[model samples]
Target: MTEQSAVLARPPLPDDGDLDLLLLIRHFELALLDLFGQGLLAGTTHTCLGQEYVPVSLRPLLGADDFVFSNHRGHGHYLARFEDPAGLLAEIMGREGAVCRGVGGSQHVYRDRYMSTGVQGESLPVATGVALHLKHTSPGALACAFIGDGTWGEGAVYEALNIASLWRLPLLVVVENNGIAQSTPTACQMAGTVAARAEAFGARHHRVGTTDIGVIRDELAPLVSEVRLENRPLVVEFATHRLGPHSKGDDTRPHDAVREAEAHDWYRRYAQSDADRFARADEIQRDRMAAIVREVSARPLSRWEPCG
Candidate 1:
């Protein structure tokens, strides 16, 4: 057995009660939609409208020392971890108060211990590198890379997985399989399942369906503990759907009736009574956004520089 695994056995699972967190994420995404519609945000933005549980499920499991690497559609991940919707809005608007100082926009927002990139399949390798560093420096820490189903075909992802598994790096690779990658459906993009690929790489793999927060908490909490304790690579494939388009102005693909119906059912089942909670959260976030808009507007238009 590895020294790290021997020293750190399976830890206790996190408690339930992530419903409030989930609702907060949902409202935050809705606010982003409002901001985008008002043209307050520069460049294209991707919102996790229906797939809030992917990040919300993982939030309680992560430690402050742990690292999170996200892909293009990663605002939910940032908000869930950092809980600073105003900072995110500022960054997306290219204001100086943004996490990246008006440099990295919606796709390239990064803060301490949390990083995201606009390119697909890029975060996996970077996250592996962070895991490698953690193995040597902070053996207790773990790194998580959030990628989409579209990124599965990238050679970089496999390369990172191979290295992580070979080195026994403490990494959790999360694939948010939302069925559609950009405008193209998953059927046209790739073959085989994400779990099979992880198995091929000799990493522990777990698959979960249904976006219910309680179901995800019950299913993922234990798996997250195991991954952190064993100090080994893990791949968790979350079967969810994206209710919104891939990005701004890219809603060409037809919606899946079955997925839509299922998503609605799940939301109603989980978030029905949370209307008051959502309203409260929404009001707070809206007020913060208003402040951000005013602050950004006060700045010279030239300060709204483009992000690379």
Candidate 2:
């Protein structure tokens, strides 16, 4: 099949959906790491590589009037809205030219009036506050928080859940439960299902597989509808996995090498099967990666800027 024909055959972009944007963001994140070597280098990076479709499918449920709060694993969340690739690249590179003024690097990037990165679960409270503020002024505005399964262990998460539920704030909390929290499996660490925990706190809940973007799209649409209509909070747990090491500096030596090989093989198969997206995304990523690499490499040593 021809190149465009292959992509056209793979998966049609959802009507009124923005999933492809996340695909572009994933490529951008990977390119930044591989080409620019500018982000979380030598340190573990919580990559949102395989989990691209979840945010893409879910983002349509959010309007510009809404707010998004992201976690350490939030590259998808930020790029879905702002489209500020250069600013993110600069922040990751620790250049004084960064969006956070170099104060926030890979995990700490943020921009006002759009989205916030850099702090874990920090968005939850901020989102909660936004919801509360909207309650006072424009109760129609909604706040969405994208957090990880690992962050479920944080006291802040539970506190936010309690506060949000108590007030019935128009909040949407999504947990990207990627099976593993760092090296520890979800079964070993997560106290219980995220949905169950949220339900116990009197928050409405839904759980869906992240692998199927369609399923997530269906799961979130109605919930967002309810939040818009009722001004309530909903907790959605997306069941997925991290296809790579936790971060850049991770030592996967103790993990199963066979599993790693299998994942890589699976990725290869998927890429090859989807002839159109693979070809297009590959070319786009390659070109972008190359440019970023050249830009970073050309920077003089004396010109290096650090985030505050």
Candidate 3:
């Protein structure tokens, strides 16, 4: 047995619905990579492979009224919110029936209250402003922004956090800290910690270290409540691992770090704990993703004209 596997306990498989969403995202990302390789896709994509659990876990917690501002690695966040793989795939493929009509491509997508951006620190300020609007207009609704740990270097992030704290906006900042930001490690760039930065702005901060959806939701339930109803800004950072490269085939990490990420990946853990259930769900999603690729690929390139 591998030493890493020996130390890491098996994570319990989530329920049927949760398992389906998780695997759906997992397969969807894998399909994207395949498409990119085949020269069937345009523009670049950042897959949230190992970080799928973050958005899937936060799925049920967020209400339809809540707004989610996503960063570069936002496929999982978009999938969890809408579950429209075909539309998103079409968007990425620049095919007809895309959510943003192909103009947004992979990084930028706008659908009602959910949006994703490729910019590092853009979403935080926008989410903070939306949170302010929700506080007054929607009453109980909140605005959640999903950011990477690398975004901590951005001045706009601190600016938005300050405004969120000062205004007591109903904002939930979800940090997907995968350790590496693009090719650079977080330790190499970031000083102090995310918790400290959030504290500096007086925003409540919580760090999540487990992959269990139940445990994560249970721990954050009341804190989310505080953000939703009490008009407070909260930052929940997940200690996640990015299994895939930053965009395409550009993972420059040392061999050991990649192995460490693989060790903590939930895919093997779920399959190991319940092979029968995991296998069925995995097959279902894999097939679903394959079908989505075929159907979206056949559609004509999306066309959008600017207004005169």
Predicted structure with the largest TM-score when compared to the true one: 3
Task: lDDT for model 2, please.
Answer: 0.67
Taken over the whole model, the C-alpha lDDT of each candidate is 0.75, 0.67, 0.91
Clashing pairs in 1: none
For model 2, how does the per-residue alpha-carbon lDDT over 208-228 read when each residue is reduced to its tens digit? 742445656776787788987
Maximum-lDDT candidate: 3
Give the per-residue lDDT of model 3 (tens digit) for 8-44. Answer: 7787789999999999999999998998899877779
Cα error of candidate 2 at position 57, Å:
1.7
For all the candidates, what are their Cα RMSDs to the real structure?
Answer: 7.6, 5.7, 2.0
Of candidates 2 and 1, the better by lDDT: 1
- Per-residue error for 53 in candidate 1, Å, reads 1.7
